[model samples]
Target: MTAPTPDTASLTSWVGDAVLAPSVHNAQPWLFRYERASGTLTLRADPARTMPHADPSGRGLHLGCGAALFNLRVAAADEGWEARVAARPDPADPALLARVSFVPGPDRDTLADLRPAVPRRHTSREPFGDEPVEEALLDGLRGAALAEGARLDFADDWRVRELLSALWDAGHAEELAPEVRAEIARWTAGVDDTATEGIPSYALGPRRYDGRAPVRDFPGAQRERDTAAVYESRPCLAVLGTHRDRPEDWLLAGQAMQRVLLQATLDGLSTSLSSQALEWPELRWLVRDPRSETAYPQIVIRVGYGPEIPATPRRPVDSVLTVE
Candidate 1:
């Protein structure tokens, strides 16, 4: 028997591409259901993989699911299928995050152009170079985010310093909170970790010796190998936002976040994510630029030219996907 191509809209193949999407703590908190009869895919938040304490509100989980949804759309388009996504189709079932149907067509948003970056994109925790992100690329990123129903605002110099200070406060506060600390400890892997999930030590990149690059300190307190390096003095930072703060908003922000990231990868830029400040209620509220109309900040992104980092592990498609 020959294997089906991705254009066939094979559940297994679409899930294969979807699993590569980034999630909080590598939690990959999502499950997919494909109906062969109607050629539709349903995305749901997998409670088993959700964080109770750190993400009691389930915002992080929603973001992870949304990222997967974005990947599924891109994969479908690149494979000659048009994907129409209906978010939260069932109002009562909040866990029913999104429903996507595959239609035969050669036209969709040219976002399929970023299909290659879907696999190449990784969250680089290493230090970025001093070179600034070009304005042309920045415009493209902004457009990508806007195309996905979200806002990406590049902070001004003063705003960057302010964001850095807030992130420092959030990280310090996380250290003092036993539950949050334990959450990170549980989600992060060690030097010799062999598990298929969670962030492994090898993908932790390096410790931030200097510079305010908001790479989440996945190491917790355990001593790791010496790989400290001073990050860039003035790292480029941007905030992904939505006009509202709700479960659906977070989900949309996640899709927008991945779109911008993929565009960055295509533009030859490495990226990292920092939601530390956004995890704290007060801090998350302040992370958004006061001048902007975007009231809610979902995630902070560090974009710049840097060395390519290794890919993180993801759960097997068979583990998170079901087709009937």
Candidate 2:
């Protein structure tokens, strides 16, 4: 018997799932095109959505698109299609981030397990409980990153403090810069529900009343009295890194990140991510531990059991995907 393959409808649904992957400031800077004749899906970066101030090198853009690629793979696996991805297949077309060709394989079940998490995984910005993540669960997260060609290192108390300080310093520095502030303003939709892309005010969680939680404070975020919540004092911070810093490395780190995030979700944990310190080259270098083999720190993640937060807005799949 011949096995089934995805049609245009299946590809469209998968692209919808792909866009759900989180992007910096919810900018959602990615595009997808499926070639029917070749049975290949191509991922591209949207130049109009690039963040010039925060992600000048396009590292964050690559990471976001990589995450979307991971989700697309998971979605395809759920439909029994094995996705083989080639990153930066064309040197001449740098914006063409990845090309994925699918085949039938037995391993589809493994990646398909994560399909349910695709919709449930949202960036929780509210305060988390004091419950410590179990060692076994942390170990699984470490393995998830490793499978995707990246590293996840849980910071010790002293290192967590250092990361906190770096985040604070970077946040203050970004606030002071007009260009950075302008970029934030452009991506954050304060109370505008009609906007398709950008961080909605409702998803901002709350203004951190106290504690060292790494929630970003978008300018003009709604600050009602009820919106101010106290965050966990001793937050569990982890640094996701790679051995080298390059566009391909960034993409790998992003896939690792989404894999970790999905696994953590399954473990019944809430999570949030911050790249404040990583936005600046000077601060980024300080994020990695001296003893760790991680050569470049890509993103900082906060994990715990926190209150349920709303999912941010994403552009319609039709707007971002082209079927040929």
State the lDDT of candidate 1 residue by residue for 1-324, as single tens digits. Answer: 442223333557767888898888888899888776666778999978887878889898888788888888888777677778888899999889988876665755596788899999998888899899899999999999999889999998999999998998997888788888777787784524566677877777777787767767753633345578888988899999999987888889989999999999999999988888888898887798998778898999899999977788888888888777
Per-residue accuracy of model 2 over 1-324 as CA lDDT, tens digit each: 543456889889989999999899888999889988777899999989998888899999998998999999899889888888999999999999999887876754688999999999999888898778899999999999999989999999999999998998998989888888888778873647787888777777878788878888887566333467788888999999999998988999999999999999988899899998999998988898887778899999999998776687789999999988
Off by over 4 Å in 2: 1-5, 223-226
lDDT of 2: 0.88
Total backbone clashes of model 2? 0
Range of the 10 consecutive residues with the lowest summed lDDT in candidate 2 = 219-228
- For each candidate, what is the lDDT? 0.83, 0.88
